[model samples]
Target chain A: MAFATKRLGKELTKLHGSLPPGIELVSAEGFEEWLLDIKVLDANPLYLNQTYRLKFKFSPSYPIEPPEVTFVNTKDRPIPMHPHIYSNGIICLDLLGSQGWTPIQNVESICMSLQSMLTGNTKNERPEGDQLFVANNRRRPRDIDFYYHDNTV
Target chain B: MVNAEQPPDPVRALEFKEKGNKCFQAGDYQGAEGFYTQAISHDPTNPLLYTNRAMALLKLSHYESVISDSLTALSLHPNNMKAHFQLAQAQIALHHEKDALESAKKAYELCMEEVMHGGKGATSLGPIMELVRRCRKEVWEGRERERTRTEKGLLGELVRDLEDRRDVEVQRLEGESAGEIQIEEVRQEYEGKIESLRGVFHRAGEVPRRRVPDWCIDDITFAVMDDPVVTKTGQSYDRSSIMEHLKRSPTDPLTREPLHVSDLRPNLALREACEEFLEENGWAVDW
Candidate 1:
């Protein structure tokens, strides 16, 4: 029987049609399973127009498991901001991790989610108190006691 | 005499990897897992094979097997960051937060170092960054939640192990004692521990909105909350319960293929409901 990587590549190739223009996945290697180059279509009011590249790696368990995603571009290409995103590109969303990972998930679905994760975001607000908060201390969007009031980002 | 140095038949291997990926995408982690195992058997030297297999195991929630696969991969290629990443995932699943954190840091450091030396670093950051954040959040801060859960889990395992050991010992003693009543007493002792350990897990979630349980597979919630019919012979449970049981361990009920939520499907109605739910909930839903 074949393994998960070949299947992922085939599925990803099939996804070329649905994927956003700026967000194209480059070649996936053994170490890096997913390579996404995102061209931010709409400029953020705070950071102005800037594009960024994102990367992803899936465990053999792709859809049934959440993929391992990260930001690859240097700080020169600033990442977008939202309540769950850290200055370091660490996303605090519940969808990607165990708190939110579902078995029905896949690469196309994750990319679509991330696209919306970026598109829906407008406030450019970093995780609360971004200036001082380290990656670990910032309360997860799921753990935060605060009721989610804003839908932006 | 034929010239050597042709890249081995990566086609079948590639196909195996693809099948594994398909199973994974379908949420059949167990199925994906078997495919990965087969893929690796076909191409035993590919570090990616182990990394992928380890991940499938993690999705199946088989942290022990995950750890083993990652360690094996790492042993083959010490500099392989994906191996480290998979190891970290297994560690996180096992609630070894400190180990997982360290493993992640090592993976990040290695990836950075590799790229600095003109090596292929995070050529793709989209998924990796998502995982980095997730690991940082879940493994770093989730340590507290994970520790509590781990302790209970360890306790449960200890009792189960002890019970099995005692059962064997007691059977041997019964043979020697020739129907002595002492076997009953020994059995009771082991049973008590198992009972108490189970109690701990039961009490763990008593707190309101307590940390998500480690044993709970978050991915299958959609199927569970949607249609839950009990299976008569454990052949296939209502999608949810079966998924839950599989999350506990993906032993195929029939063939033990390491099942996942993907291996099963909902009727068109349930499937439609899932899609509608994702849309309404604003979940990142895709085909």
Candidate 2:
């Protein structure tokens, strides 16, 4: 797990050089956490001209274990509305889950996956029980075992 | 009258050491070396001055000077881990693989002892371990090179022996009825044997020409694999990294299947390929 920092350092260097379109690194001051701003490149009306900020929190076992990823709300930035995304900024993508993560996935790849996830969505609404989950669920994103039944998005 | 044997001025030495440290922190190796040299002159018995100068010399790539300074430092302070580590780095730069390994091992032992005693330098164990790993890799590469050389020499001798036997057979058949045909057959047989032997040791002649190949890298650590093992899904990872992952989660990293440690098989051929690559390109360990 000590080698996780080394891997993250390499990923940071690569990100500094170039990243895919619609993804820009915001801050990566340390190995513990990073922030990146992402936008939907396509003119999807649901997320048109809107930029979302992503927060990546890495544990010591990152890359082996998935990093905890969520959207952060700011004054100017709003959480994207999708059936799989809650108002609380927690995403329901399987790729971010422990079962779906692989060491081959890095920060850049995750950003791209999120960008595509947002771009492909057509529902202008949150998950059905978004308010209940946001208000009552005190568990972290990784701890909450959300049933991933909706695969359409 | 100026006395040639003046007693060491500890105060001046401390001042010079402070200057040297500042220079080192400022990334001015030349300035650091100059200051450390002055500090050593003021206090010739101080091992820290010599070790400081050794570090500056190492940064300057004056590997020979670094070795001498580090040796002096070690002679003054036998338990100095920094001196041993610096000596190892200098030895490795000069391609003294065996001596480098010994120095690195000494540093590692000192680091571990310090940690066990709850010393302040316990945090230095990580860097010492890294140096030990590098030195071990260097020593392994050196032995591999020696083995390859010996094998090539033996193969050359075997080929020469075959040529001599072919010549003797041709000489014995000289002026006989079918002497020319028999001589041609003998030559062809010897040539074929030599060619096959050459093919066997062909890899020995290769010079390191490229960066580490992707096959030698473990996706888990993103570093060159020392001991690679194959999972049930046919993907390979470094043994230690995969084992660490299995300790926390008993599943294949890539496939997400329920994988136990017992399912891993040592990828011996891949390991050998990686060894050969590292033997030629020793820098791949860091890669």
Candidate 3:
């Protein structure tokens, strides 16, 4: 836990210096959780002129483990419609999954991946089982065993 | 020593220790120091009280007092990590670089021992390791300073020796047939030699621009590698970081292939390069 926090501290200092375009840090008040705001730079009709808020939760064994990332709904923010994104803000990306995650991935890299995932999407509908999963699912994003079969956006 | 007239009051000491902790958390180091002093008076045998006082004194930059209090705490409990850490901090502040490095290494060793035993102080290893690195850097800089001084003194002696030889040659040439020209040539030769030696020393004394090379940094820990090991994929990482990773997951962090701790080979060449870089730029430990 201390090692994770120290590494996060270094990452935070680097983030303060500069972040990639289309990705902005919302808040990083502690090592436990951070919020980031990302936007699709190109004029994708589905995600045009919209901002998405991402929440990242770090476990004690972070870097070795992937962060729990999910979208959050607010008054001004809405969950973007995508085939892999549910109405409840849960995302189905292999990069977020334990098997697909590697220590080399970082917060900024995650944000960029999400940004590109949004940019490449043409479908404006949620996952087929979105409504049911949103209603019945009680587990966190990291714990859910998502089968990553879909490669096309 | 306890006032033998009145028995030690452990309960009062606990109360005062709580007060000291509260004050220390609130950033009132003076108040914290006072409370810890009272706590120590109540329980003279408790090393925790002295450590608390030392921590407060450290915050207040009362380095000498911090050293004394930390020493007292260590005397009470020789393996107290906090006491050793504080003593190292105070020693570093006082520019006792060698002593600070020794104390910091002691703390780091104790932390590692605790980790090996599955004890309670595993969380403290990160900070203790960082302190050890800082102390090592300080000690290195101290030695560099001493080496520079010795080099300067040696350069002075060499220059004087050349000048003395030139004077003797000129004195001998004064009685020769072509005395003036030979004397001038002897002086010019010695002066050129002295100038070249000074140039060499000047270049040696110049401080190298501080930059940690990418090859020396471990991608896993994002730190300058002290002990680097090569993975099967040709990537290198700090040995401790890779071992820790292998403990949790038996896959290469980069290539995601099935990997084992036994698969790692010491990157002897890269390790030597990192060590050589650190010898000149010890501050890269923080990098």
Candidate 4:
């Protein structure tokens, strides 16, 4: 109840208000995890009018540390095709990574950043080694050794 | 301390001056100095501006800066009692006895004239009069030592004047600040009455006692625990709840890190905090 549930409770209360466009909170039933839906507003042909779901797994460190954020592919949600996104829905964005995350960036900002990332992208393919990494990778998204040489995304 | 980034606007400068006043009232002398500097830059000719900044500098114990600001204020408006009083105070603080005596005498004379004219300068008159008496005593003592070495006559008239001034100053200061003491006493009495009313309401069960924040409680049991333990990742849980989780899985319930029963350290600080909270709020045990 210290950092995990207490912080998530406040975040959940904030998410109930009107959010920025294209980022909608789907479910936040518990303090551990939350599901959010984000859409690229502009007519980017790769993700034109397509909605994507993001799954956020928050550790107890929470805002002091970054929440674990990745795309969740379900029956209704599909992972957007980007060079940074893997086929298994793991995104390799630096903001979700350890080195680039800041405590001030909240759930809504993360969703908007993801939405903007998709909107500005022109690529229709996943990361270069999507299939190989998706098949063998068992590490958590935070633990993954992501090479963030690509800043254009 | 003036922020050079914003373009100069007198209206904005006034706003900043008001902000400086608020900061001064809140005892943020450094912040008030910064704001006052900004205000002075926008309205440089205002004598009161320098006087206001001098007050903040005085509280910060910047004796030299206060003296400089008070000099500037006095140069612009020679009749300013505040700047004179502040100059006297700063000089005295810096142990410039002769200069302090001169400034205090001038301030006391001006303050007395203002008070005689039915002006609102009585608030400052009392303190300036006290400073005058102190400075005169210091100067007299310094001269008396020199006179003792030179075998000069003792100034009996000056000593009589000091005693007369002491009695008159004491009577006047008591009369003025007496109203303030009475108001303070009445305010304290009303505050006590209000506190008793609140206690009566509590006994009648009209108002509930305060509750602890959810963060301080155990998530599983939903109670304040005496023995709390923190995980390596910094999430604290009740010892019993975490022990039950550890028996099923050797990982933390939240972080899923490779935690063992041996890794769970007793949170001594949180345990003491919980005990203190319970001591004040015994009702929270049931809550």
Candidate 5:
């Protein structure tokens, strides 16, 4: 657990110099959380010319446990419409959950996953029952029991 | 120099330094600290990068980190006056006055050298000299406090050692007292056993009316003898008992071998052993 901060520090140092295409780090003040902006490279009509802000909150067990990641809506950034993303910004992506998370997946890899998710998406829709879940769901994203029927995304 | 594990690229490191400077000027101290750290990782040999980070961390009120960074900068380049000055300030804030004094003195010396060499005028040294003066007073007080702390620790150790010694002494005295009482109890028990044995000897009717041991008796006469002698058979008898037996055409009483009066010899050593035994156990004589 003490190595959590050290690992995150290395990730931050690596990310500071350069990031993967279509992903940029907006700010990383400490080991706790970071802000990133991601864009889909492909000309998908639903995601073209739009940059979505992602907030990553890391716990002391980071890398061992998945970081809590979600979309954050600012004036310049808007939430992308996707079958996995709720209207309120909770993403139901399997990779972001504990079951699918691995120590090998760093901030850059997660950003790339989101980028590809957006690039391959053709649906201009929020998750199923997005409005209802947003109003009633009090649990963290990792606590949600998401059924992964669409692995193609 | 600690992060010098990777080969350095001066050009890239300079780029990071420029970025850090920009961030620092824009009042983004944390960002500046990050960039400076990156620059150091790229080119740890550069002392200026560490000093720059120390400055940024100082602004962020990260006095501890400022102290460490400044120390690293000074270690990499001992003549870096700004690093020494920054370290002094950080040490002062951390209440490490003794350490701050040395740093301030070095900074002041370097400043004086610069002015002496026409690098800066005397007017620039005023602030540094003031810092040096303040550090000197604080360092003296800090040393006194440290001395008092060490003295108190030594006194505590001494008191504990004395208490331990006292405990050992008390235990030893108690053990000796218990041992003495045990010895007296064992002696009394043995005395009772000896008295009971005396009663048994009295009831047996074999006790001599005179207080003499059985070993002092002449075998032939069955009475205590004043003089002991050995027959040719190596058996000792009283002088008069054997003399009387020989006169009665006697062989050795124990060996049944023919013997004359001349064959008897004085057993002086046995007589001396018997005398010593009788002297030490006169009560056994009657028993």
Candidate 6:
């Protein structure tokens, strides 16, 4: 607990990195036992112009691994009830793949990937059994094993 | 309906006590409370009934009820050190500082005496001594801090804290902004140098009306332009007006296939056309 950790927030938000428009980093600082923040980004265009606060939980092992990310302050995005996404803000992406994780990735890259994923995919389909799946689950989303499907999506 | 098979008082009391302890271990404080309360009622004379019930209440964070139970225990048996220790904790919660100090003193006194006996000394008192010191220190610091805390009026001090907090936030934001500008500068520096097309998506738009650059027209040979098939390669080619690429990398004669226009091995006319396109667009054609 005594080990001090610092966020290079300023470094994370450069211009060429002018993140897919409308996403803003509101406030970020230490919380609970780890550091956290509320990031407001433009919602999926289907739910246009809305801002959603996503919670980021970075483990001691980050960069080498992706930070545990999720949606916190909910609005029109509907918490993205997909097979890979839980009501809590965990995302399963090939980039964050268990065996395929790349050490060079960062929050900026992850956010960009999320932006592209949201923009390119044009459906409102939830994971296989959305309602029952949500009801039965009690653990955080990162713990679930997802069967990612369809390259066309 | 009360099951007739249910055990009587002694057995039921033991059962509930064990059940309560089990639930407490499992982090089910609410279940523990219900069970301990039932067991205490079944055997009211046991000081331990009050003691365990108080601990259960304490675990539930029902501090006031813990004080009540501890006091009730002390009334039944005046020398109950556990009751005194728990009573001190509950008093602290209720802001009964003076009473907490007295009870903490009594508990510590009993423990200190036992420790002095140099035999049968309670090991639990090691931490309890720290607790007593912390409680007294808390009371002392409260008074010291309270006096200093309100050197100004409560509202004025709160307003000042709000303003100070705002100032700290403003400073942090300013720091972030300055950092962002630095990052932008660095990214710009990096962007200016690197022309490689990695993550860049081709921006789609209507074809611009600007005429194709004369450089493409001058450098490319006319024969490669008209025919889609044959090229400088002598290798048979394909497509219309590949004169654009032909000038850049003609082709291999025997193969007749257009030479790799840079890295891409497009056929004759197609290769010519690509060369013209890159020259006109001012892009690293190979890229």
For this target, which candidate reaches the highest lDDT against the unseen true structure?
3
| TM-score per model (chain B) | 0.40, 0.67, 0.78, 0.48, 0.47, 0.46
Q: Show the lowest summed lDDT stretch of 10 residues, model 2 chain B.
A: B115-124
3 or 4: which has the higher DockQ?
3
RMSD of each: 25.0, 11.2, 8.2, 27.9, 47.7, 31.3
Model 5: lDDT to the true structure: 0.74
Query: At residue A103, what lDDT does model 3 achieve?
Result: 78
Query: How well does candidate 5 match the true structure in TM-score terms?
Result: 0.35
Tens-place lDDT per residue, model 1, A14-106, is 566466566676766663366766654556454346566666766554444556666665655666666766676666665676545544455
Candidate 3 residue pairs in clash (backbone atoms < 3 Å): none
Report the C-alpha lDDT of model 6 over A1-153, residue by residue, as the tens digit: 111121223224242256445455555555212222222344555545544555666554443334566766444444653345555455666666543344334555566666666666567666566667667877655566666775566
Give TM-scores of chain A for all candidates: 0.70, 0.97, 0.97, 0.95, 0.96, 0.69
| lDDT (10s digit) by residue, model 1, range B1-287 | 11154344557777989999999998999899888877776677777888888888887788898888888888889887887877787787676766876787677657656643546554422244334434545543454466667877787678778878998989799779845568887878878877877786768745343222212212332212223222232332334334434554564443445555445644545434543443233222221
Task: Give one digit per residue, the lDDT tens place, for model 4 in A40-88.
Answer: 8988888877889999998876654678988999886888899999988
Q: Candidate 2: where is the Cα deviation over 4 Å?
A: A5-66, A69-153, B1-3, B177-179, B195-287
Q: Identify the superior model by TM-score, candidate 3 or candidate 5.
A: 3
| Model 1 bad stretches (over 4 Å) | A1-3, A16-18, A43-48, A131-153, B1-287
TM-score of each: 0.34, 0.55, 0.63, 0.37, 0.35, 0.32
Residue-wise C-alpha lDDT for candidate 3, range B1-287, written one tens digit per residue: 78877689989999999999999999999999999988888899999999999999999999999999999988989999889989999999999988998898788768766755667775576667777778878878888889989999999999999999988888777856555777788899999999999999999888877666788877776778766889889999986678677777788988889988678888999988987887778767774
True contacts kept of each: 0.15, 0.58, 0.50, 0.00, 0.00, 0.00
* lDDT of candidate 5 over A66-95, digit per residue (tens): 789999999979999999989888888877
Across B71-176, the per-residue lDDT of candidate 4 in tens digits comes to 9999889988889889989998887877997898688668756754657665575466557646655655565456554432223444445456555655675777
N/CA/C clash count, model 5: 0
lDDT (10s digit) by residue, model 5, range B18-120:
9999999999999999999999889888889999999999999999999889888888898988899899989998888878878887886687577546585
Weakest 10 consecutive residues, lDDT, candidate 5 chain B? B278-287
Q: List the residue pairs that clash in candidate 4.
A: none
